[model samples]
Target: MLAAMAATEQQNRTWSQIDVPDQSGRVVVITGANTGIGYHTAAVLAYSGAHVVLAVRNLEKGNEALSRIVAAAGHGAREVHVTLQALDLTSLDSVRAAADALRNAYSGIDLLINNAGVMLTPKQVTADGFELQFGTNHLGHFALTGLLLDRLLPVRGSRVVTVSSLGHRMRAGIHFDDLQWERRYDRAAAYGQSKLANLLFTYELQRRLAAADASTIAAAAHPGGSNTELMRNLPAIVRPVATLLGPVLFQSAAMGALPTLRAATDPAVEGGQYYGPDGFMEQRGHPKLVRSSAQSHDEDLQRRLWTVSEELTGVRFGV
Candidate 1:
């Protein structure tokens, strides 16, 4: 159980406060870039000069987000890198189509942000008949990452940043036997499994890259308690409590995106590390390196999940 990362060097920075480094030649693909934390993440990165491909499910939303980013960038004498592409994470075919489109369009990808996800919501199946949260949040990204890993490998120092949540601490880890929640479907548990998978995927991916002698880094980050569209499916009663607690405990979307921005842009980070807010409960504040749950680092489950994911998606990740 050795540490995967070296000494921690957490930071305290906001999106606007971030130092913009030259990213003109780099390309990044972010899922769920049309709204919420994903929107802010993409906008900030694009505004800083990284050509951003927004992999989203809805073209209308993606175009709208692109327009906003473009318009916003016009004011500061900065030309933001931005583009919109269709990606429905609920379907394996859709995931492949998006990856193929990116591979065909770009020579190398500097960053891949597995940012799209679903929260605690009703039980539904994706196009492939898997549970909705698990499918869209974890499996979809797994397939997409595997499919595009070759393109990523060629770009030395490339990184894959997966967005997870503090809810991961709640469920503890994956329920391998009932991962799909066949017997009983607790929405929160399902979401927790998906989030935990994000961490596991990050670590397992790093292990694979090392085994293949690749330098690509895989890291994870969480937004804390940001006001994002992730709460769209929560019970109506949950809003008032959240609203009341938000001002004191939650952060703005821009603030919430800091950790992700840092993980994406910071040169000091290492593979298999995680970042989140540094405030009380690690719920809201500036970006900082943080710890993940014990289950997140379970090697056995990680390998099993990797095999299952490859078999299910028929995609093999490359070095």
Candidate 2:
């Protein structure tokens, strides 16, 4: 019984709590920064003095977020510069183009936040014919991360933070042969698979970085239950259920971002750590370390996924 309790406690403290000093000279790229938790994260980072690049799908929405950030920053707005860049995760071409533009503009990226994702979205195909959720949430970020890895590695203390979710636990596992679900499609199942992939990628990338003796750190975070636009596509039937119990089960967007913010800025954070809210059901609260399933740490699946992603995107990341 004591051993069981100790094991549980150890899992809970995977990421230490420590203050992250100012990020005056840091450059950060965040996806889906137009609204919800993404916007709050960008705003907070900008307020804290990081040069934030908002990688949004809609230019107009991106501009709005920039304005909001500027307004929120007040006189210190000069310390935080928000650059709006177009990034449609569903399109490989768009991802490649945005990466190119970012590389041309910034010599090194201190942080890359793979935050943009769709949740419980309707079954649809992306521009490259991949499932929408998998395309945007997993493959898109994979390609972008690989593309920007060189710039990231050059920086002395760079980090790539990938946002995942508790939905991952619902996934059976990655269906490697039929990743796109050509034969069938289940919205929640697909979303869960993608979230699980995010964790696997985070762990696998950390391993790869260790092997290459790189200075960069790779980590993952889940917002708990932040009630973001991620659930916009949930079937109408589910919204009523969510509304009836959302307050009891979900946290505000600002609170939802704490785990992510912690992962990005915490000085004590190391590669492969995962963070989430420390609440009764992980539905909301302060940032704390979290545990993922044994499947998420599988080395074989990570390698296979990385290889397949490069082939599908036609853009190698190590470049």
Any residue pairs clashing in model 2, and if so which? 146-317
Tens digits of lDDT, candidate 1, 35-115: 989999888888777899999999998999999989987675777778988999999989989989999999899999999
Instruction: Write one digit per residue (lDDT tens) for candidate 2, span 74-185.
Output: 7734567789999999999999999999999999999999999998877799999999989999999999999999899999879999999998888558988799988889
lDDT of each: 0.86, 0.87
Name the lDDT of candidate 2. Answer: 0.87
TM-score of 1: 0.94
Identify the runs in model 1 with alpha carbons over 4 angstroms from their true place.
1-17
The C-alpha stretches of model 2 lying farther than 4 A from their native spots are 1-20, 76-78
Q: What are the TM-scores, per candidate, against the unseen true structure?
A: 0.94, 0.92
